[model samples]
Target: MNPLLKKLQELTTKLDSTSETLDSFRVFHGRGKIYPGLEFVTLDYYHPVLLLTLFNQPPEHWLNENLPLLQENISQKIQTIVVQHRYAPGDPSEIVYGELPEQVFAKRGALSFHLNLAKQQNIGFFLDIEPARKWLEQQAANRRILNLFAYTCSFSVVAIAAGAEKVVNVDMSSAALNQGRANHLLNGLDKNKSQYLAENILKSWGRIKKAGPYDLVILDPPSFQKGSFDSVKDYTKLVRRLPELMPSGGLVLSCLNNPDLDDQFLLDIFNSACPQATFLFRLPAHPDFPDAESNRQLKMLVFELATG
Candidate 1:
């Protein structure tokens, strides 16, 4: 029922030169997602980022409709879609993110959601790692939780609801935090348990530290952010400082979202950057997911201070 997805189906069916399994894919600026037929997998590692289309057996004509949208432009190199969903007998897997699937994909225990369905962008809830939120909820009681770049505050709200003494959600947009606060209310959380500020994380870490040695720290930063961050240069600065915010043996959930950056990259960054900490473990996904790696969008590191 999504117009963009419907359009994607139309374009792929009409591709001039089609392949069974497309390895090198690209996303030219367009109104929709693009991909090959359902019989194979399609992706562009260099383009925008990591657009994917993998599926079982889907309708060729239906998938073809969306191919036009994936055509590459020599100028802007970006992946058109992040990943595609295939289901329903007439379903298509060799698809992209243009139109989100109709499925509601529930958030697992101790979790809330903030996602945009049917778009070739990030999912609202990042449903891949619900276990991390559950862990936060289990540990939040009587402690302060600092959530940085707290997009929807799903982490903050769950922390507060789980009995965190207080929570401070920091980001660059108060409006976004406002939605986060609303999520707190949605879960019947106490407003007094949480606080929010909109500020650049890099520019404001000292002030954040002044806020104190929080019980828990969560950092799932974007790979490349135009407005507030540069992943390659800024990530270490941010990653290194996280330990200072936690008390001895406190918890730190450090994450990286750029699929281009592998899980090993995160492990190395945290090990070197936060020397005072010992690795806990990576979080797991909910039962609904068939592909576990998708949740690897960000590699999460759990650590407790060595000094503590």
Candidate 2:
């Protein structure tokens, strides 16, 4: 047998059904892999890709083994691995397993992700926004929050944890919104305090504006979306318009995932568009992420904006 197949054959077997989302799958504690109660299983739809997860070990070799491949191909860096539970059999689903790009090797606890079983990409949470997550956790308590482009609602999870009185998550994808809903449930957030909205941001701003005058708003749009935006020329316009939705002391958590644009572009946009909203700080990027000099193609920026 080949090395890969040989590795799989070595795994010990365990079986159980997933009550939360999936029906069932057999679990394997591969000899060389990590965890006891932890398991590796695949979903029916995406079994083509292996879902090496832990009900019980942290993510290991999968990411560490693959980093060289990712880094060699792109200097922009892979800060986290977004591992989603693949629904199909025999596929490459381990690539993006977390919101962050690095293969984190914590000696304790099983690995987990915010990405839902249904989303195509492995990214459950936006890993690049790790620090921003902590930032939100710190700032959002007791505030009225809105999350735009709220994929899987990782930001909402943090905001709710931070004690936000109410959080409205807006997204275009029903699947994505559903995942965010799941997250709110996962974190045991109060049902009455959180709300989910499925809408197009550019067109739904009227509704958003009414719901807002928010104390905290998160804007982490996809780099380029098909129906709603072309992040290149139109992103600044969106940034410019957000001040209308914010209260004087409200904070906007603005993020740009497009690496092609430089940080200076974001600085310029903030300078010109929301001049009244003080630029509190740019949250620190993750450590595992490659240095900016190594990357020439990415422009991921997370900023703290407060309406002064």
Q: What's the true lDDT of residue 170 in model 1?
A: 89
Task: List runs of model 1 lying over 4 Å from the truth.
Answer: 1-60, 63-123, 247-249, 285-287, 290-297
lDDT of 2 by residue, 110-157 (tens): 222343332344435544466777778788878998888887777777
lDDT of each: 0.60, 0.56
**lDDT by residue (tens digit), candidate 1, 123-172:** 34454456677678777888878898897788887777777888888888
- In candidate 2, stretches whose alpha carbon ends up further than 4 angstroms from where it belongs are 1-119, 292-308
Candidate 1: lDDT of 119? 45
Candidate 1 structure, TM-score to reference? 0.62
Highest-lDDT candidate: 1
Cand. 1 Cα-lDDT: 0.60
